[model samples]
Target: MQSAQCSGRTLRFGFFEVDLRASELRKHGIRIKVQEQPFHILTLLLERSGDIVTREELRQKLWPAHTFVDFDRSLNKAMTKLRAALADSPESPRYIETLHRRGYRFLAPITPIREDPAESHANFNHAALERAAASLENDQSQDHPKTGFLLSHPRPPATWTWFSLLLGTSTVLVCLTALFLLRVNHSIALGSSFGNLNPRRSVAVLGFRNLSGDSQEAWLSTALSDWLTTELSAGEQLRTIPSESVARMKIELSLPNVDSLGAASLSRIRKNLGTDLVVVGSYAILGEQSHGQIRLDLQLQDTQSGETVDAISETGTESRLFDLVSRAGEHLRDKLGIRAVTREEAAALAVALPSNTEAARLYSEGLAKLRVFDALAAHDLLLKSVAKESNYALSHAALATAWGQLGYDENAKAEAKKAFDLSANLSRAERLLVEGRYRETAREWGKAIEIYRALSEFFPD
Candidate 1:
C-alpha cells in the first residue's frame, strides 16, 4: 500500500494533481466535475497506487452492510465515470489498468509535493521573484550597480516595482486568453464528437408475462410484446432493438418472462444488448373468458439507473388487442418525449400487420422460437401462420428464416420470394428487414450485410 509519509498527501501525475486532504482532483490547476462515488474510488486507488485494489476490498470500503446495492454494477459505473474524468482507456491505459477478473491497478508514476502546506504559497512567490530578478539583471548591463539590488534587498525600488507589476499583468492576461480558447475548442470538439453526449436511446421490449393463468393465452404475451416493439420502432428518434435480438438475449441470459427485474439483471441487459430503456410488461384476461376484457400493464425502466420511468395500463377486449397495443405504444412514446405517430405511418403499420388474430399469435410465437434457434418448432408454427393469412409478409419473412435455419433451402427461397412479393405495403424498416432476410436465405451475404448496415445507420443508437 502507498503511504503518505513516502509520498506527501498531495500527489501529482501527468498534468493532473490529487489533494488527499481536500479530496480533490485537478487538471492544469482546474477542478474536474467528478461524482462522489467515483471520487472516493479514485482516492482508494491513489492510496494503493501501483498495487492491485481488489473489487472485494473496494466494496467493503465504499458500501456499508445495509447498503442494499448492486455492488458489481455500481463499481463498474463508478470506474467508467472515473475513467471518463481522466480521459483514460482500459484498452490502452495511461493511468489505470484493469486486471480482468482480478482487480485494477494505477499505472502512472506519482510525485509528491512539499509536506508543509503553509510553505507552498511562499515557495511559489520566491520562485516568481527569482525569475523577475533574473529578468532585471538580463535587461541591465554588468556595470549597472542595481543588477544585484533585487537579491540584496527584500523589497524592490518603486521603478522596478512598477516594471514587475506590468510584467505580471501581461502574463495573467495571456494565461486567461489561452484558458478561454482551450475551453472553447474543448466544447466544440465535444459537440462534434458526441453530439452533446445525447444519442438516440435504444429500447428493448421484453416478452410480456401471461397473468391470465390460461396456458392457451401464453402466445398473447409474445404477440403483444412483438406488436409494441414494432409500433415503438415507427418513431425515428427511438432506436428499438429488434424482437429477435431481445429474444436471443433472453435465451442467452436465461431471463424469465416477467414484468420486472432486479438491478443486476437490468444492468446485464443494458450491457449485453446495448439497450438504454427496457419495457417489461404483463397481460391478463379479466371478467369473462368468452368475450373477456384484456388488461396490458407496461413499465419503462432505465436500465442503467434501474428506475421506472413510466407505467402504462390499457384495457380492451380480445378483438381489439391490436388497438390496445397501439394505445400503449403511443403512450409509451409520449412518456419518452418521442414524436407522436403520423396518420400515414399508422396506416402503413395497420396494413402491414396481419388482420387475423390467430395468424398474429402463431407468427409471434414462431418468430420468438426462430430467434432462439428452435428451428423445427418455428418452422411448424410459421407454416400454420402463413396458411391462416397467406399474404402476411412478416410471417413469410420469418418463415424464410426458420426454413433456412432448418436446412430446407428450397422452402426458404420460396418463402423469401413470397415475402418480397407481398412487401410493397410494408413500412420502411419492415421492408428492409424482409429484404435482408431474403438476401440471407439466397446466400447473398454481402447484400444482406449492406441491407442490415442501412437499417443500423437509420436507427443508430
Candidate 2:
C-alpha cells in the first residue's frame, strides 16, 4: 500500500516514477528494492528537490523520538546504500549531491504526473513560494486598492507591463543565484590545497586522548601532541599554542577530559589562550604496540565559528609516529590555505637538545607557560630544568624571557648572554629569540625591531 501522505499520486522525474498509491518505484517498467528508511529518505529528498537537507534535519526526521547510537555513521551508511541502489555516484551524481560537512541535496528536477490536490511537494523555498502565491492571489482581487501604482493618475496599461515586471524579477533572481554559485566555487578553489596553510591563524593543539587500556601510554599522548605542535610550527605559517598554555588553561578550567570538550568549552579555552583554532583528537593503540597499529583522529575547530572545519584520521605503526605527526601538520596547514613556508633554519633549536626526556618535557612546559605570561611558574620550572642540566640553552633562553617579562633587566641580560654564548649549536630560531630579548633590554629599539622583523618574516608561527 502507498503512504497516505503521497496517496493517489504518481510523481515522475527523470527516468523514474514514484507511485505513492502502491508504494512502488519504476525505472522504465521495472521495480526495485526501496527499503523502508531509504524509501522515506528518498521521498523527503524528492520533496525538497534542489535544496540542501542538512544532517540535523535528516536525523530529526528519521530518528525522532527514537534511540539510535551513532546516527551520523548510520546516516552515511544509508546514503551510500541508497546511492548504490539508485545507480547514483556521489562524486558525479545523477540524482543526489553530497555536500561535505553539511548534508545532501537532491539534484533532479521534480515533476508530478498527477496531483493529489491534498499533498504538496516539500522542496527548497516551498514556504516562500506558498507565501508568494497567496500574495499574488490577494493582489489579483478586484476589491483590493492599489497604493503604489507609480503613476500620477489612474490609467489603464497594456499587459506588456506585467510581463516586463515578471521578466525583470526572474532575471534578477537568476543573476543573484549565478553570483552565489560563482562565489562558492571560488571559495572551494582557494580552500585546502596540498601546500598552502593559513599563516596568521593561531592554532592550539590540545592533548590527544588515549583510548588504549594501558595507563603507561598517557605520556605518549602528550608526547605525540607535542610532536604534532613541533611539526606544525616548522611551517612558520602555523602559530601553534605552546603546550604550557594549553596545560595551564586545562588545569584552571578543570577540563580534564579535553578530548570530549564541546564547542563551548573549546571556545572558552581558545579565548583564554588567544588562539584562532583548537585542534583536538583521540588515539588508540590497537592490540599490542609490538604487533598492532596506532590510530590517530584529529579535528580542527574554528574558534570564531565553533564549527569543526577539518577532520583527519591516520593509522600507522608506533615506529612511524613522527611521520604521522608530520603529515598531520601538513594537512592542517593545507586546510587553512596557508602557503607552504620556505622557513629558514629559524625553526631549529640553537642549543644542543636535552637528552633526558623528563628535562625536555620540563623545558617544553616551562616555555609554553612563559608564552602565556605565567613567568613565575615558568621561572621555577626553568630553574629546575637547568639545575638538572646546567647547559640547556633553550631553558636558559626561556628563563631569560621570564626575567625580562618580570622587569629584571640585569638578570634577563645575564641569562640572555649565557643562552646566546651557549647557542652556537642551537637552532637559529632559538638564537634569534634570545638575541632579540637582550637587544630589547639594552633599549636598542632599531636593532630589536630589525631582529624581531627578521624573526617574524623567517619564523611566522
Number of the predicted model whose TM-score against the real structure is largest: 1
| C-alpha lDDT of candidate 1 relative to the true structure | 0.81
**Candidate 1 off by > 4 Å:** 1-198
Which structure among the candidates has the greatest lDDT? Answer: 1
Q: What is the lDDT of residue 10 in candidate 2?
A: 78
Q: TM-score of each candidate?
A: 0.57, 0.42
lDDT tens readout by residue for model 1, 1-461: 45863357678888788887787888888887788898888888887889999888899889978889988657876776687577664545789887755678988888887556668888888999999988887756454665444334367789999999999999999999999999999999877855645577889998888897888888887888778887887856787887767876875566888988888999999988999999997988886754688988989999999999998899998778879999999898889888888998899879878899889889878876655445567778999999999988989988887665444578888999899889988878889888887887788999999999998666544
Residue 288 lDDT in model 1?
Answer: 71
The positional error of residue 440 in candidate 1, measured at the CA in angstroms, is 2.8
For candidate 1, report its TM-score: 0.57
